[model samples]
Target chain A: MPAIDLSTTPLRELNQSLHALAEGNNETEWEVLNPDGRHAVAVGIDAPVSVDIRGPVGYYCGGMNKQATVTVHGSAGPGVAENMMSGKVVIKGDVSQYAGATGRGGMLVVEGNAASRCGISMKGIDIVVKGSIGHMSAFMAQTGNLVVLGDAGDALGDSIYEARLFVRGNVQSLGADCVEKEMRDEHLELLEDLLQRSGITGVKPSEFRRYGSARKLYNFNIDNADAY
Target chain B: MCGIVGLFLKNEALEPQLGALTSAMLATMCERGPDSAGFAVYGQSLDGEAKITLQSSSPEIDFPALAKALENEIAGAVKLTQRATHAVLTCRRDELDTIRAAVRRLAPSVRVMGVGEAIEIYKEVGYPTAVSERFELKGMKGTHAIGHTRMATESAVTTLGAHPFSTGPDQCLVHNGSLSNHNNLRRSLAHDGIQLETQNDSEVAAAYLTWRMKQGLDLGQALEKSLDDLDGFFTFVVGTKNGFGVLRDPIACKPAVLAETDDYVAFGSEYRALVGLPGIDTAKVWEPEPATVYFWER
Candidate 1:
């Protein structure tokens, strides 16, 4: 493990130094000190490394990551791990829009609430938000699993695709293609696994309900044209 | 400092007369970014073809000679057909920057201004309405568009220091907050070979997005890529020929709302600004998530 001190060095130099370290060295974990909401703190890393951002970030904290695990001790701005291809990004605080959006692979775990379009158009990524989510949480989500441990706001999955959604609390309303689904054995098992993976404990597994695509709107039927 | 409007027709067939719609929306936002106004409307049938509006500081220079030089030297096939206090030209999409550079060289004393999309960027030291009228902005149209009214806190407020600054042809940005580390980020973007047009902090954001977009990323992906890299407490709106997108700062200081129906979608600095548009469902008008990106493709 190594250290990148952002306190005295300009954030650009500090980030560059860290990126260089990740690129040139073999250290698997790096500790950052005095990180104050800088953008692209640890972006475009291809190695298996863990970066602990000690403070908040402005936006796109660990974007386009592959085989890297970045953790933010504070809040994050919009687009954390956006378009990520592989690995894991864990934000301890709240995250802004399109968190893990269009992600082809990997997992994003947000311990706090997520803003609108949390997992928008996600492809093959699994997102577990421990708190509530805002409007259009998963708009046009083509694939992946969005597991929310709390409530969801308006348009949970409007114009959705094959993505599966599981919510533990009340849903304000379902979007265009999203609907309530039965919480069966497989769903409970999936919920338990996601909760455990997200490090969430103490809540009963049966307390949550499952919601996903109705599959009727997958092909855009003329009869369902009026639905939108 | 500036305003931008863009129209992308979904049908890509009718060449939707978006002039009136774009003009109307841009007019409403004159107060948001009064320095300049411009619009970029792409042809309906063309995959990425575009129509652009430009303004220059030096009106006396001959634009045709510069266009010729661009064609001969830079391989930019451009032609100047109209000349005014603010010059207008119909140019090849790939030749935009080259034509702009030629204008700068040909007329060193004058300012070479707004290019790409239907954006008619204007800049001055005054109100938005006067500039809107000066640009004759009420007549333009498109399918979907966005505009900005700016109050500059950092950077010069010149024509180059306007809102809805173009990162690429169709990707334009208008920001309401400041970037905390714009200088460093600007240097990084410049290091990546992306040009910086303005000293405004918002341009740093615009350049970041544009640079990412040029790397073969979609509009949404590019925006997401910029989030962690761009610092500050800001809310920004971007209108591209392909779609409309908005993002708020982490703390969510500035206010924004997303209102959508099957027919239309709108986001504004204030809900009242969108009051004039059709189909207002009070129930559907919702505040945007902080540090979140809301993108809709047309």
Candidate 2:
């Protein structure tokens, strides 16, 4: 176990150390102290290590992560876990805008509420928010599942694609080409798995309503060939 | 990009540390806006006393004579505290306009930064820390303060282009985004008899709020109306005599974080600016929503 205090050591040093880890490095568990809302903490890590950040972080924490788990004891600023691949990230407190945005693969969980564009243009990632999400969430998302246990703000899943949205509470309004769809048993199982992974309880998967693209914006037809 | 930081104190005990706290907060945001910085401090007001903050390109020549001329013309006791290139002239409250006119007459090169009973504005085309240090902001005492660091997106890098733009007495605003409709809005505001000192877009926003307030709207109402009238991305932190407010445009591309406790309310473009505050670890921190207004008054 290793501990890095960001207030004393430069943030780049901590991130560089994390990036320099060799295969099967003995120092697998790391603790970050006094993050103090700085930007780009623990970013671009490819090791299978667990980094526990003890305080709030600024922009783009845990960005482009791979094969690691990063947990923030406090809230995260914008772009937390952005472009993460094959890793787990958890924010125990509220997150700023674009949390887990454009993630290629990985599971990100926000125990607290998220600001707008929580998963804008997300690709092949799964995000579970224990609380509500803000407007324009999952906008034009090409892949992944976004589960919001609490209410969603205006324009939820606007112009979305392929991504599955499950909200137990109200949806202010759907985005263009985004409409409510039937929740099949497969969707229920998927939602259940995401909830269990996020350690969510006291909420049933059956309580959610699903939303997805209407297949009108991008889909083409022979009759409309001339329009292109 | 630009940075805006504001602190409104609820407890009197924390007032003495207001400037130091705000300066630290502003310094943390230097990366967001490195070209210039400005801040407005709302100090404790006395009976019928107002101050006008003035800045000049050549303070050595403009400030001393201007202070003496103002003292004689106003026929009242005048105190001029000089910083690097700025000065605060404390005088009789009713004579604010008279002194403003006198200073313009006495020193043609001097620019009145802001005028109010409690507000003292200082802005410069420099880094945030040096600007704060030159003004001795760490030693100043105030009840609340709003600060801005500018990156010079839509305007040139000059003292006037720096933020914490003042348009009305005891009112100031710091903005973090650009306005697309400023040229059009500036014309409309000018047509309505509102004068602006700078071609900076943020000043137009300040004038708009001043115009709204003149129409009998409070700070909160004025900010709400701005959501519809002002076009473009912005996260504005506004300061009045007794209160400070925060408003973000509906598109909300700009970021704003707010933290509140029993002692004070704080606003930062990002949470990083607030880490140095006392008891901040336990403060209730959250990002302000888009198209919303959050204000605090002592």
Candidate 3:
């Protein structure tokens, strides 16, 4: 295990050293100390390593990650795990806006609340938030599963496409072309697996409400001109 | 992007450190908005007296004769405390309007930053640390203060365009996001006899609140009205003589974090600004809900 003190080592050098490591190397475990709310830490890693950041990080931590596991002990700034392809990113504390934005694959878990646009344009990633999320959490989401154990803010899934949303608590409002749909057994089974994968317990899948696109705005229609 | 920070002290012991704490918070936000910065402090107030904060490009020439000329014009005693490029003019409450008019007539180049019994504003076109140092903000004492770092999206990077815009007496507003309908609202507000100072969209927001307050609406009511009437993405932190308010638009595209403890209520564009405050780790931290008004008054 390698321990890097961010107070003495620049973030760029640490990231560069992490990026230079070969896959499946013995030096796979790393620790980042004294993050101090700096942006873009542990970004663009393509290795199967594990990095634990001791303190709060600024924007875009673990962005575009592949096969790496990054965890933050403190809160995260905006865009945590943004555009991640394949890996696991975890925030022990709260996260700011656009968490897991545009992620294609991998799992992002937030122990605390996630701010606005938590999974905006998410393309096949899975995000599970133990706390509430802010407005427009999954705007224009093409595919993925966004599970919120707590309440959601306004416009939960506006302009969404194909993505699935599960909220155990109240939703402030639904977004354009996004609406609550009936949760059948298959959806419940899917949510159950997601809840298990995210290590969420004590709540059954039956308690969650599913939201997705209405499909009315999927194609151009003359009657939909007024809504547009 | 722009950054906004506010500190409202509930404990009297922390009053002396208001400016220092707020300066630290503002410094953390320099990356969000590096163009310019401004701040307004609410200090001790005197009965029957008003404090007018003024800024001059040529402080050596305009500020020296300002206090004496304004005292003569208003027929009252005036005291001037000059910083690098700003000054606070204290005069009789009844003579505030007359003194402001006299200063405008005496020196058109001088801009009035704010006017109130307890508020003094200092701002300039520089980095947050530089502006705070120029005004000696760390040494000031106050009950509450609000600061802004501007990114200059809608307007030029002039001193006048700097934030903490004060259009009404003792009332100033700092906003993070741009308003879409500000030009139309500015015209309507101007038609309603509200005098606007700059083309900056944020000044219109301040004037709008002032106009609402003048119409017998309290701060909370004015903020509620703003949710319905004001169109745009905004997270506004407003300062009054005795009140500090935070409001965000319905969409809440802009970010705002709030933390409150037994000693103080603090607001920042991000949590990092609040991390350095005393007892922040134990404070009740949360994100402000959209279309909601949170205010604290002494």
Candidate 4:
């Protein structure tokens, strides 16, 4: 394990060192101290490594990550794990807007609440939020799964596409082309598996409701002009 | 992008440190907004006296002569204290409108930054640290303050385009994002008799709040109405005579974090701006929700 103190080490150097590590190297465990809410920490890493950040971080933490496990002990700013390719990024505390936005793959978990636009435009990632998610989460998402245990803010899944959404708590409103769908045995089994993989418990998979695109605007028929 | 920091003190004992603490917070956000900076400080107000902050491109020639001219016109004692590019003119409370009119006539270049019993605004087109130092913000004493550092997106980079745009008596606003409908809204607000100062969209937001408050809405109500009337991405921190309010647009693309302790309530564009506050590690930190109004008043 290697320890880098961000209070003294420049963010560029720390990220460089993280990127230098080879895949499956023995020194795969790293620790970041005194993050101090700096932006772009541990970004663009493509190794199978673990990074434990001791404090809060600013925007774009673990952005574009692949096969790297990054965990922030404190809260995170906006765009955490944005466009992540693979691996996992975990926030022990709350997160700001657009957490896990446009992520293509891998898992992003927020132990606390996520602000507006959480998982916006997510493309194939698996996002699990233990707490509430803010307005417009999963908006225009092309593909992925977003699971929330707590309540959701206004206009959840607005104009969504191809993404699977499950929420156990109340949704303030639903967006265009998004509607509640029947939770069949397959969806229940998938939700149960996702919950188990994300280490979520106490909430039954049967308690969740599924939402996705209604597909009415997939090709834009003339009848949909009034809704537009 | 722009950075905004606000401090509202619940304990009078911390009044002396408000400017220093707010300056530190503003400095941390210099990277987010490097074009221009400004701040509004709320100090102790005196009965029957008003403080009018004014800015002039030619401070040396205009500041001295304007104070004497204002004194003669209002028939009262006028005190003018000059910072680098700004000056605070203290006069009888009732004489503010007359003094303002006189300034418009006497020195047309002198811009009225703010007029109130307690609020004094200082702004410039420079780095936040330099602007704060030029105004001696670190040594000032106040109960609450709001500051902004801007990266120009909506308008040209000028001293007049800075944040902390004050539109009414003791009312000021700092915005982070550009409004899509400000041009139309500005015309409507101007039609309603709210004097607008700049083409900047944020000035329209300040004037809109002023117009709403003039119509007998409280600060919270004005902010609530803003969600419906104002369009575009915005995270606004507003300062009043005794209240501080924060509002985010419905989309909430911009970032805003809030931290509150028993002694103070603080707002920052990001969590990094708040890392230097006293008891911040123990403070209750949260992100302001979209289309919601949060205000604290004495």
Candidate 5:
């Protein structure tokens, strides 16, 4: 394991140094110490390497990530793992707004709370939040699975296109065209697997509920006009 | 700080380009602030008025009184209506200075940043694009402009407290970082009879530059004085009728990236915002020096 000290170095220099150290066919697990809320730190990593960021990030951390398992020891700013294609991003602390936003693929696990608009416009990401999420979470979500262990705020999943919402706690309200779905055996099994993958094993899978779009607003329907 | 972007073509050729450019800049700096967004478009003449559009805090002061005072004291014919905090007014181009002066007098507690004849300011409590869309910013037009997206750390979060703050006639400023000597400088400027509008630390810097410019100092000299007098980590860009100026604190705590070519010049809180612009001279990209003043003439 290699260590990159970013105390006094600029973020671009730190990224260059880390990338330089990771280059040359060196697939080493690197530890970034004293991150100190830098923006775009450890972004666009493609190598099959693992990185552990020490503290909270400023913005766009781990953006467009591919094939890199990045873990943050602290909270994240907006657009964490944004547009991610592959790999895993694990946040040990609460995350700021727009976590996994517009991500196409990969898994994002938030151990603590997440701010508003989490997974907004997400294409194909899997987000598992152990705590609550703010209002307008998953707005305009095209395709994704958002698992929230705690309560959600107002207008959850408003204007969603196609996304699966699984919540263990109370939901404040459903967004436009979103309705509660029956949690059956298949969903329970899938939730169990996701929770276990996120390292949350204590809760029973049957405790959670499922919510998704009723397809009422997929096309313009004069009969269901009032639902909109 | 705030983001300012406006385009004033002699014949309305580059409205789309300017709006796209401003939107790109704001989107790139979205993380710089996710608070409020507002903007103005200058060419729309409704009822033979200049059709100045503005966004601000809701349930504001009376526009009639503001317009009447501006008409009497500032020498402008002002007609203003409030939709929430945003006020769209129309006045003669010559009366812009008087309107600005009267606004300062009327809204002493309001941060009057971003004052220009064709000025556009977009600020809210979120990313710049979202705020811009909420305010329907795509149709704004002029020859040139300025905008701001604010991150609330030192000041309270309100539409009245957003950026692209106006200092004087045809002058607007967008600030990125803090000004440590705001209180002391505010008192000194107040002693010089410059009434302040907001509690924001950056407002003092904007007002200081405006007062200096009002005293016949050029933008470069006023910015230089601010670099010398104002304390703390600040990187700001000021726009005027002539052009725009960029300044940074000696400590260099804030960050600004500049990209300029023969056709256009752009600046952002980050470089990615300007990455995919038209006619981008990627090689000429550079960050301005700390405590240095850089301005572009119209």
Candidate 6:
């Protein structure tokens, strides 16, 4: 394992060294020390490496990540793991606004609560939050799975599109075009796999209530104009 | 894109380090708002005594005889302390009105920064770190302090346009976003006998809160009322004589993080600003919710 202390070294140097990693390189495991709430740590990585950050990080911690497993031991600021293509990012503590925003392909696991706008505009991302989520989560989402273990705040999945939302706890209110939907065996099996992969046990898949887009705002029309 | 930081020390043991901690917190947000910066420190209040912070372009010329001029009219021995381009005049609480009138006549260019028994305001049109150094912020001791760095989207980058706007005695406000209805609010506030000093939207926000508080509203009630009356996206960090408060607008696009330990309560626009605080690793840190009032009082 190669260890880098960010307090004494420039963040650009660390990022540059990581970006320079080749496919066949032996330096596969990396440890980042003293992140100290710095912005854009471990961003834009394309290699299949494992990075363990030791402390809390500021905005956009694993942005645009691909083929990497980046784990933050502490909380994260806004836009964490934003716009990821392919990767696995895990936050051990709470996260601020818009965690995993606009991600195209990835799996994001948050062990703590998430603030507002979680997974906004997501595309094909699998997000699992062990704790509650704030308002307006999964807004305008397309092709994703959001699993929340605790109570969700107001306006969950507002103006959503083609996303499967599974909430085990209470949802304060649904958004304009979001409504409760039936959870078939396929959804139960998918949620089971997601829960098992995320190391979540003891919670049955049947406990969750599913929500999705009402599909009324898919096209512009005069009758359903208010929903649009 | 302004940055705001506030610290309220619950542990009196950390009271002496309030200025250093707040200055460091503001320094981390320099990139967010580089146009100008300002701060207000709420320190201990002396019985029957109050002070007013004044600023001028030429402190060397205006601050020299200000003490004697105020003492002659106010019938008390005025204490003056000058730092960079700003000065503080301390005297009997009831005689401040006379001193204000005398300072206007004696030093025509001096502008009052803030007036309170326990608050002193300092501001300059420069980077936050450099302005903090000019104000000797690291040397001051206080129970609580709030600071602001302005990006100047809605107003020009002048000393008055800088934040920590003090519209009420022992109360100051620092903002992180622009107000949309400040012009109309300014007109109505003027109709209600509240005069604002600048076209800056943040000053209007401060004056509005002060006006609401004057209408028999507490700080928390005034903030809750503001959610309905004020039109804007704002994350405000407010400082009162014995309290520190934070409020985010309904949409809450402007970010704000708050941390509370056994020793202190701290507010920062970003998590980076709070990383340097003591015991922050174990502190209960979280983002302030939208349209919520979080207040800590002594």
Provide the lowest-lDDT 10-residue window in model 4 chain A.
A216-225
TM-score of chain A of each: 0.89, 0.97, 0.96, 0.96, 0.92, 0.97
Better of 2 and 5 by lDDT: 2
How big is the positional error of residue B172 in model 3, measured in Å on the Cα after superposition? 0.5
Best model number under DockQ: 2
Cα error of candidate 1 at position B158, Å: 1.8
**Per-residue alpha-carbon lDDT of model 5 for B48-72, expressed as tens digits?**
3343445434455666666676677
List residue ranges in candidate 1 displaced over 4 A.
Answer: A1-228, B1-52, B59-85, B93-101, B109-125, B281-283
Window of ten residues with lowest summed lDDT in model 5 chain B? B2-11
Q: How well does candidate 5 score on lDDT at residue A129?
A: 96
Clashing pairs in model 6, backbone N/Cα/C closer than 3 A: none
lDDT of 6 by residue, A1-228 (tens): 989999998999888988999998899899999999999999999999999999999999999999999999999999999998887999999999999999998899999999999999999989999999999999999878999999888899998999899999999999989999999999999999999988899999999999999998766779866865
lDDT by residue (tens digit), candidate 3, A1-228: 899998899999999998998866899899999887788999999999999999888889999999999999988988999999999999999999999999999999999999889999999999999999988889999999999999998888999999999999999999999999999999999999988988888989999999999998777899868975
After superposition, candidate 5 runs with Cα above 4 Å error: A1-228, B1-13, B38-84, B93-116, B120-122, B281-283
Poorest stretch of ten by lDDT in candidate 4 chain B: B57-66
Q: What is the Å distance of residue A165 in model 6 from its true position?
A: 1.0
Query: In model 3, which runs have C-alpha deviations exceeding 4 angstroms?
Result: A179-185, A220-228, B59-62
RMSD of each: 18.9, 1.4, 2.2, 2.1, 19.5, 1.5
Give DockQ per model, in order: 0.02, 0.87, 0.45, 0.77, 0.02, 0.82
Fnat by candidate, in order: 0.00, 0.82, 0.12, 0.76, 0.00, 0.76
Write one digit per residue (lDDT tens) for candidate 4, span B1-298.
9999999999999999999999999999899899999999999999999999988887466688779988889888999898988999999888888998999999888888999999999999999999999999999899999999999999999999998999999999999999999999988877877767778999999999999999999999999999899989899999999999999987778889999999999999989899988999999999887788999999
Q: How close is candidate 1 to the true structure, as a TM-score?
A: 0.51
Per-residue lDDT over B1-298 for candidate 3, one digit per residue giving the tens place of the 0 to 100 score:
9999999999999999998899999999998899999999999999999999988887466675778888778777999999999999998899989998998899888888999999999889999889999899999899999999989998999999999999898999999999999999999998999988788999999999999999998888898899988998899999888898999997787888899999999998887788789998788887887888998877
lDDT of 4 by residue, A48-155 (tens): 999999999999999999999999999999999999999999999999989999999999999999988999999999999999998888989889899999988888
Q: Pairs clashing in candidate 2?
A: A158-A175
